[model samples]
Target: MAATVFAAQGASVAAVSTTVPAVKEHLGLSATATTVLIVAVALSAGAGSFAGSAAIRRSGPVAAMRGAVLTSAIALLLIGWAPEQATVTAGYLLFGLALGGIDVSANTRATAVEHHYGRSIFASFYAAWSAGGVTAALLTAGTARLGWPPAATLTAQAALVLLLALTLRAHPLPAAPPDPATATGTPPIDLGRGLWIRLAPFGVVLLVAYVVDSTVSAWSTVYLHQTLAAALSAAPLAYAAYQVGTVTGRSCADHLVRRAGPAAVIRIATLLTAAALAGMAAAPGWPYAVLAAGCVGLGVSALAPLCLASAGRLRPGAAEAVLARLNVFNYLGVITGGAASGILGSAGHFRLAYAVPSALVLVLLLTARSFAPAQGVGGGVARTSPDW
Candidate 1:
């Protein structure tokens, strides 16, 4: 049930991301305006993450999920039907708020489930997220192929999000004692103290991963259409392919960790992602770009869930608070990636945008050693691989 809600939010993300090009075209937004629109969502989402953490402390993940999911649907409707820049930008901000809330709550729930199982199962939740992205991206492509306007396409997606929001239900998980701070009506963890030092490594990895992610997810469609000369109906294929790659990589991530260890996996995947990004930047045609995007997804997919899992490990008892703060890096990466890519794409320098991340991603290598596998509930860290 938790994973399902998470996936639905993923669909929401894809719905917004894959339609960015259409959104720009429909409203006749200038490049700078488009960049601002993307940055607004990222900034708002960061704020929403803090709001979500507070809500989770007050109500619980289920209530937070319900509210966020509903907000996402409304945001989609507002964006799709809006006739002007002001209204559309407002909708994007609303969507960002929902996205951030869903993110913190969903990961909080997922980490609880992982602890209950006493295994490193975080990737599966992310795999579900990628699966949802694939579905929505393909849906966008299908609708575009059928000559549906962006408004109509987003409306259809809004319906789907509304359906998911309705289906969300609370389920029982392993019961744990309430946080002492929550009982006292105080903050869950002191974000200002030693927490940031412990979280810095995972946060760095997360920031880098999201930079790659937002760049591709937010701009790949536009890149294909403008730089690679793809048709409107085909522009979303790159996003779909990228999601498919993430699905594949995340599906195999846990098993790979059990076999190869997280550090080794991160090392190899980081290198692969860099190579893939370079390929994507240099692709001469949309088809090649689509294939390269998939490769980029495959390489980058495992990093995020692993980062979240590792960050949770640092403060298992306060996973929600930790994850919420960690989201600061996530949205920072989004703003950096989305705004930079949009600005560069506007200037016919899209290739440089993608290429820059290829090198920036190598910084992940410095952080790879930090991805220690989850020490299952009662089980100590896996003995097969030495802790980095």
Candidate 2:
């Protein structure tokens, strides 16, 4: 159920990306205005993370996830049918909030499931997310080919998200008591300095990962259409290709971690990502850009799940609280990448957008050692035999 809802969130992200051109055309929005609109989602999502943490502390992850999925559906509906820029902006804000809440609540639940299974299973959950993104990206392309307007395309996607929300059912987990700090409404940041210090490296990796992600997912279509001269129906292919690569990479991440270790995996993936970004920056045509985007996905796929999984281990009993704090970096990356890429793209420097982040990703090599002990075998987080 956790993975399922996460997939729905991925689908929403794809829908937003695929419809960017339509949204801009329909509302006559300037590129600068569009950048603000996208950044607003990240800022609002950061605030929503705290709200999700509070919901988890009060009613548990299951309940919080249900609320988030429902909110996502509503946000989609508003965006799909809105007649003006202001209304669309409102919808975007709501979507951002829902996206943030889902990030915290779903990841919190995912780590619990990972703990129960006693191995590196977090990557598989992200694999499901990428799969959903692939499906949505294709749906967008198909809808556009059939001459569907953005409103109709988004409305159909909204219905799919709503259907996913209705299927959610809670499964019982091992009985554990709630943390007293959470019960008393204390903020997650009030936790000791040592925990934040431990989170720093993982947080940096996550920040860089999302910078790569937001750049590709949020602006690749625009880059393809404007920079590479791709047709409307074809622009979304780059995003779809990226998600397909992520699905493939994440599907194999667990086995690779078990064989080579998390630090090794991070180091190798970071190098691949940096190279792929440079390739993307230099692609001479949309086809080459699409292929480079896929490589980017393959290389960056493991970094996020590993960063998150390692951070969860820092305070197992307070996973929700800790993950919420980590989300600060996540949103910061999104805002930075989304806004900067948009501004650069607006000024017709799309290549620079990808090129700059390539160097930023190389910084992750320094943080690879932080995940050396993230696996159970290394005496990081404890493991239990598969409950199944």
Candidate 3:
């Protein structure tokens, strides 16, 4: 149920995210201005992580989800109908706040549900998010093709979430306490304050994944429209392609993880993505560009979740704190990477912008080993060859 609501929220925002190119034209925004807008959204979203977590703790997940969804609806309406630059910018921030809350609350609930079931079902939750994103991208394409006003389109998307919310159960699910058993059989490595050092690789990997993700989500449409001369209706297919890969990759990630340890799977996947991104940057036309987008989606699918899984169990009782800090890393990557790509695109270097993150995939390749099972909180587990 929670995952379903999260999916609706994901779809609503994805519509805005993938259609930025169209939005820019709608408001006559400069590339620099669009960059600023995206950066603001990413920054505020990071803050929402902490704020949303607090909300969940106090009011419960259902309340937090409801509040966040409605908040996003209001923000979306403002964005769709705002008369000027400042109004739309304000709307982006408000949307960011709501997105942050939704992200945390949904993930927290998913984890709890997974724990209750005593198995690994968390991947399905993320697959749903990607599915929503894909749906939104497709919807945006269809809506644009039909010559719908961006304002009406966005308002309808917002309404979808609000209406979906009405059907949800009134109360939140029971909070599943954090699993006491260590995630990795290995004993915990208490770095004390130095735990940051141990967590650096996880952070680095997540940063790169998000950087690439932001680049794609925020710029794919722009690239297709401006660089390839794609029709506005077809441009969002680039983002849709990316999300399709994301859904398929995540849905099947556990199989790969189980077949080949995470290290091998992630490293190989990064390599494929890096190559795919390079291909995307040099795409000759929209069809090729969309194909490249799919490659990228599959390539980056497992990175953020794998890293976060490792980050969460780094410490015995500090899981929340550690996870919170990692969330900050996630947004930081988006802000830095998304801003850089947006600015570069603004400057007529969209190809270079796409190419850069492709290069960063190597950095993730180097850090792939970081996804190894975490140190035990008390005693180390048996160090099996494939355990990592």
Candidate 4:
């Protein structure tokens, strides 16, 4: 709920920020400035993730999450009242830091919960996140339509986040015992144990998935506007469709994992994603394009949580550290995805953006073996018995 609050608030800010010509004008910026803002946001988000991971290592997940939520609320309020572009950017940087901490802490907590429950729960947790994004987008859109001031909308979101934080007082799950073999009186993770070697292949899959996800989130609307000549009001529906697919896919991810296992599920999902990307690239009309994009969303939906689950299985005690390392690559993919889309769109080759991810999906299929079940069910800490 706290994450939802932050997402909603951020969305409100985005809606207002894009429409407020005065905000950009005050900074003497152009359309290109928006691109820079996005890059800055991604970079800040990555830094936040890095810092959040470190904090999680020091303080437990619950404390880290609380701090994250409080800090984010303050940052949102600052952004709401900022008097200059520099202040606004600083606000965003703080927001990014908060979001990063919240993200890692929450995922760590969720993973620990799943391990305790002995089932797959990451999908459901992520579904809540997707729902939060959808809710935020809708709320922002509605506020814009209602002619609410940007500051007012953002302030409303901040208030809700503050309220939500008050209810999250539970302690985090217990940390896993340190492996004497891997421990050196420091963190549990063994970088020398070919950890990245185990993580990299799956990380590549996550990179491709994030690239496609980011591209659609950041560019689908613009693509529809320029390529299909869609109405300004209708362009956002393309993104909406993608989110809907993501929500749907996440809703069903556990079932798919249980029925087919992770390796098979990932293989099928990669193929599905590739096909969806192709359809998106080849679509001749807006309807077809939206359909393809939604398919892409559906196909890639479970990749992140599943990949994180796999990473958890690889090194049970060091899941947080493993995820932190993978997150670096994941954020890099987001940055490159957005930049690649912008560059391609500028060159009148926007279709190539989709094509690039399709190729990556193929590579994912070829490297599927690296993520084969390593004695675990749903990538939880425990190993799965062959009879079961």
Candidate 5:
């Protein structure tokens, strides 16, 4: 059920990416304006993470998760139905808030489930998210073929995704007891000592990883068309290849992490990311570019899931509070990645944009060891059985 919530979120995100060109055309938005809108959405999402922490403390994780999904549904409707840029931008902010809330709430819930089940399953949950994205991309293509308006298509997808989220409310876990930090008159998350250094690296890694994603998603089509001279009809292949690679890598990520641990998984994945980016930056043609995108997708796939799983297990406060803090990095990544790519793309530096993120990943390599475990899941939160 927690995974389903995340899957629904992924589908909505994929749907939006699928329709970006259409949305831009419809609203008469420049590339810069659209990217700025994304930045705004990301900022709101960061703020929403804090708000979600408070919501979790008051209403329990279950309610907060449900609310976040429902909120996203409404935001989608607004974005789909809106006639002007301002209205659509406002809708994105609302959607961002929902995304932030869901990120903290669902992951916190999933961390508990993973620990209870023993071994590793968090990466599998993220695999479901990638699969959901692929499914949505397929849906978007079908809708486009049927001559459905982007607005109608997005609205319909939102409704279906929301219904799916609604049905999964309590299957895997019941409502969490309200986090006591709200009532204890204390800071929600413990930012003490080693926890800060441990968490600080995640922010940098997540930001760099997300910028890579943003650069590709926002500009792959343009890069293929303008730089590689691919026909417009075939430009989307780069994005599609990336999604497929992500699904492929993530499908086995949990097993790999379980066998090797998070630090090793992340280190190997980071190297692959750097190698892929170098290939992408120097690709001679469309086919090479497309293939490199798959590598990027596959290598970058492990970071988010691993960082999140490790963060949730790091204890000093409730997982909800800890996750809420970690989730802000996602928005920072989204905002900066999208905004940077948008700027570079506007200046006609499409080929160079992917390189920036690649170079940033090398810097991230320095922090790879931060993902190492200092301790197991904090005591008293939940019990685990190896038999599972």
Candidate 6:
């Protein structure tokens, strides 16, 4: 439900951002002013992310998620009613703060759930998120057909969020008692450990996979419309295809992991991801783009869950902490991928942005032989391969 709210509001905001030129005309503002407004929104989102990390560390996930929902709803209300530039900017900042808080808190919750379940479920959870995004994208497109004003559309989204929040309260998982062996809180197993060494290649593979996913989600619509000369109405279909593929891929990931093991799965997925990116870069039309996007989604789908599951298997007692540390790198991928995409697009080489991550995946494939096999629960670290 929280994901749905975020997806709906995010899609609405994206639509508004895309129609900035028309909005400027309607509001009697220059193109420069509109560009500044959008930049302000992006900056506020960054600040919110920084602030939210601290908030999650201090307040716990349930409080943080609730705060994010309430704050976002209020911000949307302000955006709907405020006429002054200063007020609008402040609302955008608040909206960013809410998004940041939600992002951190939700992931933290997911990590906790995975630890408690004692199995791989992260990819399926993310698939649920993609389902939310798909719903939001469709709703936003429908609203566009109705000729709804941006503010009104956003306000309606806020109402829906509030309703969802009321219907579904935040439920954080209970923290388990710490085991003394791993309870020292000293960062579990240093980077030099054999297990860490063996896991490094798999980690690198997941990192590059995340970067590829982020790049596609952030830029595929624009790439479809601007670079491929697709109709604006059809651009979002690329994302829809990707989301569908992710959902489908995740549904079978656990079985695949059980049947083939993480090592074999990662190797095949990495190669497929490289091929998918190459296809996207060379796509000649919308149909090809959609097919390529689906391939990309399927190829990248199991990477994250496999990494998290591997981390859990590596140090069952310290799985949460290990996963958390790896998440820091995952976030770095998101940041760098977005910046790289922007730079490449500005230089008229947007395709390189996708291709570069493909190369990174290939590098991960070369290093794949080094990953340790999936050790069943209760198995000691001694039995794990030293290649990680």
**Candidate 4 global CA lDDT score:** 0.66
| TM-scores, all models, native as reference | 0.94, 0.94, 0.88, 0.82, 0.87, 0.72
Pairs with backbone N, CA or C atoms under 3 Å apart (clashes), candidate 5: none
Cα-based lDDT for every prediction: 0.86, 0.86, 0.76, 0.66, 0.74, 0.60
Candidate 6 regions off by >4 Å?
Answer: 1-58, 69-100, 147-149, 156-164, 170-203, 309-324, 367-388
Q: Write the per-residue lDDT of candidate 1 for residues 309-332, one digit (tens) a residue.
A: 888766666778899989999999
Structure candidate 6, residue pairs in collision:
197-388, 198-387, 198-388, 199-388
Q: Each prediction's Cα RMSD?
A: 4.0, 2.7, 5.6, 5.1, 3.7, 6.7
lDDT of 4 at 352: 86
CA error at residue 191 for candidate 4, angstroms: 4.3
Candidate 2's C-alpha lDDT? 0.86
lDDT tens per residue, model 3, 165-253: 66666532233235432122333334478778878998898888888998999888998899899999999998999989989998987
What does candidate 6's lDDT look like per residue over 1-388, in tens digits?
A: 3344334334434433333322343466543454355445545555555565556556655566667767777877776566766776677677766765665555555544544544455566666655655554454445645766657656765675576456545443344323311222244345345755656665676567767876777667667766787665566667767777777787777677657766787788889889999888888887798899889988888887666555545554444345445554465565566567756765677788888887777776675565445433223222221110
lDDT score, candidate 3, position 32: 87
Lowest lDDT sum, 10 consecutive residues, model 2, at 175-184
Name the runs in model 5 displaced over 4 angstroms: 172-194, 225-236, 283-288, 373-388
Which tens-of-lDDT digit does each residue in 1-388 have in candidate 4?
3234334333433333333332444455454654555566668778878787777778766667778878877877777677877887787778767766776666666656555545665676666666655554455445546666556656766675676677675632344333311122354455556887878887898888878876777777667767777654455566766767777888898777767777887888899999999888888888888898779878888888788777765655655677777887677777788778767865677788788878777778876766655234433354332100
**Cα lDDT for residue 332, candidate 1:** 90
Error of 1 at 377 (Å): 5.3
TM-score of 4: 0.82
lDDT of 2 at 24: 87
How does model 5 score by TM-score? 0.87
lDDT of 1 at 67: 91
> What digit string (tens of lDDT, one per residue) describes model 5 on residues 1-388?
7778778877777766666766776788897887787788788988888888888878766778888988888888888888998899989899889988888877777777665554466777777777777776667666766777769878877976777676764543333223322122355554566766768888777878888887776567667767888754455567777777788888888878767877777788888998898788789999999899889989999888877877776662477777777776777778778888778877887767888777788887788787765234332234433111
State which candidate, 1 or 4, has the greater TM-score: 1
TM-score, candidate 6, is 0.72
Deviation (Å) of 47 in candidate 5: 1.2
